[model samples]
Target: MSNIVIYHNPKCGTSRNTLALIRHAGLEPTVVEYLKTPLGKEELRALVAATGEPVRALLRAKESQATELGLNDPTVSDEALLDAMAAHPILMNRPVVVTPLGTALCRPSERVLELLPVGPLPPFTKEDGEVVNDSGARRA
Candidate 1:
């Protein structure tokens, strides 16, 4: 298996863009269609841990069920959030990229660059037309 893994949602523009960026960078990553192969508790926890983000950050508060399940409450524990995410994969965010560089929740898609191996990057543009130069700097 490649060191890079991307939890992808093909229907999501951001996820598709992130994957494109990875390919553009010359690395073929292992794609996990998390919605299809929903992450188990251990896998979810590991991904969250790899990103070093609070478990809540990995939760998609905008998911319809988040509010319905009371996950919007601040008092909700990490365990509860993880459980919710495992049970309802939609509760998890999209395009989490993991690589030796680190893990990132690639919201803007370009964030995946931080987790890629150092090399000459290809010109990259996001779905929104945001340009990321070869040096990983966003071109204004």
Candidate 2:
């Protein structure tokens, strides 16, 4: 098993694109479909800590229930947010990657490159048809 892990949601284009980048790097990552196999509160906390981001940063605030679930309330505590995310996994943002080098919330997909092994990558085309060159820069 590779020392890389990606919390993924296959239905999400960004997640799919990020996974493709990992494959393009000639490495395989442990894919965790968080929606299917939800992470426990503690696990979610650990993952957030690993990313050096607040719980709100890893939250999928655009989810329909985010407002209804009161997750948007500014007064909510980290523990409360974590509890909600653990109970309803959809509240959690996706495609968070952990590698030996670092952890990142790979929303742009290409952000995964930062944690990937340093090497030349084949030009990659994302779901939106944007191409990233081997140096991890978008081809102009």
- Show where candidate 1 strays beyond 4 Å: 136-140
Estimate the TM-score for candidate 2: 0.93
Q: What is the C-alpha lDDT of each candidate?
A: 0.88, 0.88
Top model by TM-score, which number?
Answer: 2
Name the 10 consecutive residues with the lowest summed lDDT in model 2.
Answer: 131-140
Query: Which prediction has the highest lDDT against the true structure?
Result: 2
Q: Model 2, which residues run further than 4 Å from truth? A: 134-140
- Per-residue lDDT of model 2, residues 1-140, tens digit only: 87989999999999999999999888999988988899999999999999898899998999988899888888999999999999999999988999887888998898888788655687899989999876653212
Q: Give all TM-scores, in the order shown.
A: 0.91, 0.93
Q: Candidate 2: what lDDT?
A: 0.88
> Each candidate's root-mean-square deviation in Å?
3.2, 3.3
